[model samples]
Target: MTMINEPAHTLPVLGEYDVAVAGGGPAGFAAAISAAREGAKTVIIEQTGMIGGIATAGLMSHWAGSAASSVLQELYKRSTVPDIVEKFPWQGTINPEKLKFVMFEMLHEANVHVLLYTFVSGAVKEGTTLKGLIIENKSGRQAVLAKTVIDATGDGDAAARAGAEFVKGREGDGKMQPVTIMFKVAGVDYSRAVFPGGFEANLDVPKGKIQDLSRQALPFPAGHTLLYPSSLPGIVTVNMTNFIGIDGTNADDLAKAEYECRKQMDPIVKFLRDTVPGFEQCFIISTASLLGVRETRHFVGEYTLNEDDILASRVFDDWVVLRAKFNFDIHNIDGPGLDKNGAQKHFPNVDGYSIPYRSLLPKTVDGLILAGRCISGTHKAHSNYRVMPICAAMGEAAGIAASIAAKEKIAPRKVGVKKIQDVLIARGVKP
Candidate 1:
């Protein structure tokens, strides 16, 4: 790598905020809403035009883990699909468009300033404290000052740029879980569909057929194709392609991954229509706008959540958030073997685990907090907390913590954990 020198120039300053959140995914959305509801002048900067990140842009139309947070429950209630309870009795399916609108409505109701199509290039820091953020948009480069900053970028972008220590992928060769591109197919024949429990449960479709398809189709890491019924009738979303050994944070790798994943879609779609019964008349509707990066940078926070914490269902004294019943579900890091039978560790008896407030505070960054998958955790633990529901819960906690810090003119790490927990409890979140 080489560096290029450029002439210095003055940059415009955007409006100051009490709490500034980077990323507009489930975590960022919840953080902005929670902070604003707490009377903090909050602003959310999202690179994409829409607020719901993976759910809307990535076409991940399913909600995993228990929807325990009030924010998630509210979004589910606003869903356009009636009888959601009956259709998805356990973890509900989402209509992405409906979710986008609901997120916009909630953010507006809370009066949270949202800057879409804006990218946070880097952080402006003085010693260990982050002073402002360098943002690039259509108007060009500018700065946005905030009393408290939340790194919810999912890749620890803000924290990493602020000189906070972090880790990427698993140990050894640093291999990460594969990136995926989800697509929707319309005109599915539900009446003729032979899915017993659902598409995932259609195991009678012969293993030889899937193995043959995997060998003949475009390079797909997942040994088997998986589909889920969407909120729309006669429509199903496919999660069949996985691009292995690609580092999502690298621009070149992401570009290649996106291209290769799209290339794989046509063959998979053809195979589904020709071989699968229900998809005989199906056609590809649309693919995700963004690549689904399963694992990436995990910031080194005040506390790093480990496998033991998750397995023992540890309750932290500085509890600020909770993750509902879920297991360590690590997808295959490389090559094929990404079926449901891939590497997984289930906690069938455990109810849930508490995520300490310390995990959201970067070890060396002051006035900075983290939300979502970027929070401090080992690779295995990150798998469980990286889902939408858990990320939303973490965001809500980070937002409240940021609000308290801004109000008291204190560092985010110094904000009282009990205060945050209390606010969350009042807002119908389990501490």
Candidate 2:
């Protein structure tokens, strides 16, 4: 690799605030809105035109893992069909279109300064502490100064740029999970639709592999045509079309994944119509504007969680997320198919686990909070707590902690778990 040197220049300050949140996804949404509600002047910068990141942009509207927080409750209440998940197999579902607007309305109500179509160019750092973020948008490159920073950028973009110690992919191989392109199909016959635990498929699996997959009740030739229904009738979500070995944070890999995933749509829809019973009339209604990248930079934090903690459903003294639940839904980075404890140890029951606040505090950085999939955890553990609901819950905690730290003139780690827990309990977040 070669480098080119450019003259250094000072950037104009975009604004100053108590808390500056990078990324406006589910986690960022909760983080920014919750921070504002905590009496902190907060600003949230998003890379896309909309606020809801993967949930809305990636079109993966299914909400699994843990109970809904107050923010999620309000979001679901204002949705077009609040009870969309009444019959859905998943824990919850959302109308992605309506979800976007609800987040916008909620952010506005919380008085969070929203910056859309903005990218975090770099992290503004003061030693190990992040002072703010350097953002680039239509206006041009600028700086956002803040007392505290929340790294909800999903990929840990801001934190990584700030020299935070983090891990990428598996420890040895550096192979991360595959990227998915979620699409929607219309004219589905729900009564005849066979949702074998979130999947529909074509008649193309090898006999021996089919038997192996059937033992686990996993869709044969799985990771090909999984179906998650939408709130509106006749429209169903397709969670298949996996591109293995694609690094989400890599630009070249992402571009390739998007193109390849989109190209799989025609075949996938055809497979549904030609093979599946209820999807005989199904057609491609729309494809997501973004690709759903599962795993990325996992910033090493105060306490790195592991599979044993999740498997044993361990609770911590500084628990931030109360009773989080999700399987180790790890996609094969070296091959195809989902790896859910088959290669590792299977969780014995459906018991939920707790995530500590310590996991959200980056070990080497001050004045910064970690949220979403990027928080401290091993590759296997990341697969467990990387779901939407848990991410939102983590974001909620991050916001409250960040605000308290900013107001009290302390680092996020010093905000104390008791203070954050009290706030969460008062907000009706049931354990």
Candidate 3:
């Protein structure tokens, strides 16, 4: 490979805050809200126009978490959608848009500063500590200083750019799970479609039936295809198909995957309309605003969680967040092939698990804390904690921790986990 040298340009530092959160996803939202609630001058910088990253932008139907014993329970308790749909007697389903609004309301009420349409490009580091971050937008590139920084970019973009130790893809050549482009189809028939046992059963439709279908097949991005109900009536969101053998961190590869995924969409809609009993008149509405990335850079933290922790349903003394059963949804990385038996594999757990604060604190970085899927955890454990609801809890903890650090004028890692947990408990978060 040939390298070209480009001169680096010097930039001026902008404003400072007690805490600066990069990314406005579930974790980022929670972090900013919690930090502001603790009286910290907090700022959230997001590239997307909306606050909810994947849940809103990708229009993910229902969050993948157990209805009982998890952070999702807290979400339900705080959500207004339940109140709106309470008369229907239906249980457990969050409207992505409503949830996004709820997060926005919380952040607004907490007085957190929001900077949407801004992307974090790089960071200013001194020794091992992050002094500030460089962000770019319509205006120009500017630096935002903060006493404490939390990386909830979901891809560990901030930490990875700041010389933090990280891992990408999986072990043994670093292959990762497949990426999907989720879209919604309207005009589905409620009566004809099999509702099995509700969301879980609807999701776990027998792959044998899917594979053995003699009808017209849905063209997918060279992998497994599956569809389940969204929040709206007579609508289903498709998580079908997979973009295989693509590295998510590479811009060129990611762009190709997105293009390939889009090309596979129409035939999928056609197949569903032709073959699926309920989707005869179903039409393709819209694809996700952003490409759905399953895995990305994993920051190395003080404690790396593993599959053992997931299976054991481990509890930590410094536990700061709660997680429900999602599973080790590792798509075959060897290359694309028919995953006729993919959804059948389940992650058996005794109960929900606790995410330790140590997992969020990088082992090397002194001033930065991590939240969301990028937290210090093994590749296997990442599969479980990578979802939205759990990330919110992690964000809440990181935010409060950052606020405490700012107040005490200490580095984020140096803050006591017990104190953070206490703040979380006070803020109605179950640590």
Tell me which residue pairs clash in candidate 2. Answer: none
lDDT of 1 by residue, 246-317 (tens): 988999999999988888888887877876778889999888997999889988888999878877878899
Q: Estimated TM-score per prediction?
A: 0.93, 0.91, 0.89
Off by over 4 Å in 1: 83-91, 194-202, 206-218, 339-349
lDDT scores of the candidates, listed in order: 0.81, 0.81, 0.74
Encode model 3's per-residue lDDT on 1-431: one tens digit a residue: 99999788877766789999999987888788878878999999998988888878877766666412223455566663554321222334556677777767777887888888999999989898998799998879889999988998888889988889988867556767778788888888866764322212323233345433412254533434466665567777777646777777788988898888888887777766655677889888777887888888888888998888878888888888754566665555543332322332455774888888899999887789998888988767787778777787788788889999999999888899899877766656554
- True lDDT of residue 217, candidate 2: 38
Better of 1 and 3 by TM-score: 1
Pitting candidate 2 against candidate 3, the one with the higher TM-score is: 2
lDDT of 2 at 222: 29
Q: List the residue pairs that clash in candidate 1.
A: none
Cα deviation at 217, candidate 1, in Å, is 5.3
Error of 3 at 332 (Å): 3.1
Off by over 4 Å in 3: 1-10, 66-92, 195-208, 214-216, 220-223, 334-345, 429-431
In order, how many clashes per candidate? 0, 0, 0
